[model samples]
Target chain A: MIQVAVCGPRDASEAERAQAREVGRLLAGRGAVVVCGGYGGVMEAVAAGASGAGGLVVGVLSLSTREGANPHLTVAIPTGIGEARNAAVVNAGDAVIVVGGSWGTLSELALALRSGKRVVQLGGWRIADAEGAPLDGITRAGSPAEAVAATGLFV
Target chain B: MIQVAVCGPRDASEAERAQAREVGRLLAGRGAVVVCGGYGGVMEAVAAGASGAGGLVVGVLSLSTREGANPHLTVAIPTGIGEARNAAVVNAGDAVIVVGGSWGTLSELALALRSGKRVVQLGGWRIADAEGAPLDGITRAGSPAEAVAATGLFV
Candidate 1:
């Protein structure tokens, strides 16, 4: 199964949280493993969605305690590297789907782009260059279904 | 001298590059040392500006090779931790000044905020919460001078 990272903030709105959950559910339903930052908000929502669907959920935590992860995670990786673990999350995912806006989401987007990984934005940052040109290959999806479909994982 | 991190993309535009340079010079003029991702683009520009002003600059490179740092850096520390080295940049800086927008810049901002470090945005992200309130204490400056001054390091 392909690992899909659903990244966003720990304090997102309810709509954004719902979007993340749907994304997680869709990805998991398609036999894809879901990965997240392993904290609250969107992470918790994603983990809960995947777990509710009996899908494998991995939490790459910045803290050193497995208990630090959301209760839905099937596997918890405590890196104790703080925000640096963002790299580990991106590296572990086959593709990354950004659910909403946050500095951490932006970082994951940057790393994914730099590494030439497939990046899909559900409702987050649309970064561009100084000339107003899109720097990396960033795809925008209007819905969770489109976002997971765009990943081409199920195909 | 205080250590300030000047973070942005390695592929910044000419204007953003110039902005980074001025930021570096301003920081150095105040007897402050500059730190960066230690690659190209804004990092190189900041290092150049500081080195030209006879100020000290440290490049915390993501690569293990010291040669990966820009030539303008006075000291090079290669972590080989990939993008994870962003944690090192934030930890080494007494404060951080974001010169432009990028995924890497966004990550640094998040990490700095989480750690409760002083963050000054020159021309980068303007992050807000779900309620449209500033999530963290983000200081915005119109010019590089104002940005560096707002850091309150020279005070």
Candidate 2:
């Protein structure tokens, strides 16, 4: 099954979290496993959404314990390697869907760029500089459904 | 200086979240850097705690589009690599301290074990079963002070 990882805030606001879960739900409905860092914020919200929709959710945990993870996750992969687990999350996913924003989230984007994975950006921070946000040209979705549809072309 | 990484649960029931932050504070007191996936949960919480306690926090983000790191982070390593950003988190930390747990946390643990880095488990899920948990007979600390102290033996 294709894994669609939703990377974003760990303490996301209610609205952003809702958006993340909706994205997970739609992706899970498409039979994709929704993957995340697996704790709170976007991870928990997305897992809840996907699991609510009867989709498989996988958590790429950085700890050796299970203190973190959504109640819906089907599999737990222990990287025992700290941030290196991000690679596992990115590698497992066929496509990358980033939401909200964070430094770790940005790193995930870099991984996607390096891995050549299908990338999509949802509501979050933007990568801007003197040359405007470069990601402005990349795949950007305004809603969960649009993000789902946008992924169809990538897969 | 030691480097510790914490991941899992943003709104982790106040108490749980408190413990994560306390761990970070303890680590930071030793002039160690708190490295994390760098968003929220134990990651942001600990980063906040560490920075509040005058410790350096480096956020190894996984996306480039979003660099919204926690307020405590001193350095934002924007990794525009998607999930591949996990590798940077583990590599950056000198001693990886795991608090709470999740699949992403687990994957990080796996990478740490694969790299043979000194790992300290405060509390969380079990990564191994029949093969046994990585770092068998490893020192498990209940408090952040002990966890940081334990890190000294390895590095």
Candidate 3:
């Protein structure tokens, strides 16, 4: 099954959470495995959405044990690597869809771009060069559907 | 002993390579273990420097086996997680030092910052907000010695 990594912040806004949930549900409906950070906020939202749709959700947890993993995950891989697990989350996905931005989320975006993985950003922080020019790698989408469509995996 | 993560691009300039080597050497001299990405360019250089200093160097490899690990490492961990191992590299360190810039390097830097680990930049691409303001949290150093000092692990 195609694994899609969805990255976002734990301290996310309501809109971002809703978008992530919708993205998760849509991805599950397409028979894709949802990958996430396995904590609270956007990760929990996405996992909930996918689980509600009876889809497989894998949480690449930073903890060594599944102590804090969200209940929606079908499988939880506790990495015990802290924020470094951000790299694993992005690497597991054939494509990455970012719902919101945080320092951790930005790391995943950068890692995905570095590895040449297709990345689609929903509502998130903007990144630019020293001169304020936007870095070219990410595809920005307006809604959850647009974000999934931007991944170009289903089509 | 303290472990320091050294992050940089595989395709590095001569200056960056030299700086990474010096950083490794200094860390080793201070009795710290060096952690790196375990491939070519800056990683290889840092490993060489640490090994030459009779210090332990850990190469956190992305490959499942020790296919292309630099010979300078004292330990090789083949994570088989591709670029996801980048997170492991940073997670193993108490502090992170960046020699230069690349998409991968930037990801490490971001991850380190997100984890609240002290990060020092030797020579790297600069990150700024969309409004042209430089992001806070990175300690900029002019030289390898300065970078090592900035980590605050030696003191």
Better of 2 and 3 by lDDT: 3
Docking class of 3: acceptable
- Chain B, per-candidate TM-score: 0.95, 0.86, 0.98
Q: What is the DockQ (computed on Cα atoms) for candidate 1? A: 0.36
Using lDDT as the measure, name the better of candidate 1 and candidate 2.
1
Per-prediction DockQ: 0.36, 0.08, 0.44
Number of the predicted model whose TM-score against the real structure is largest: 1
Best by lDDT: 3
lDDT of 3 by residue, A9-62 (tens): 899889888999999999999999999999989999999999999999999998
The candidates, ranked best first by DockQ, are 3, 1, 2
Q: Enumerate residue pairs that collide in model 1.
A: none
In candidate 3, how many Å is residue B108 off?
2.3
Of candidate 2 chain B, the 10-residue stretch with the lowest lDDT total is B126-135
Using lDDT, rank the candidates from best to worst: 3, 1, 2
Give one digit per residue, the lDDT tens place, for model 1 in A20-83: 8898888778889999999899999999888888899999998988766789899899988878
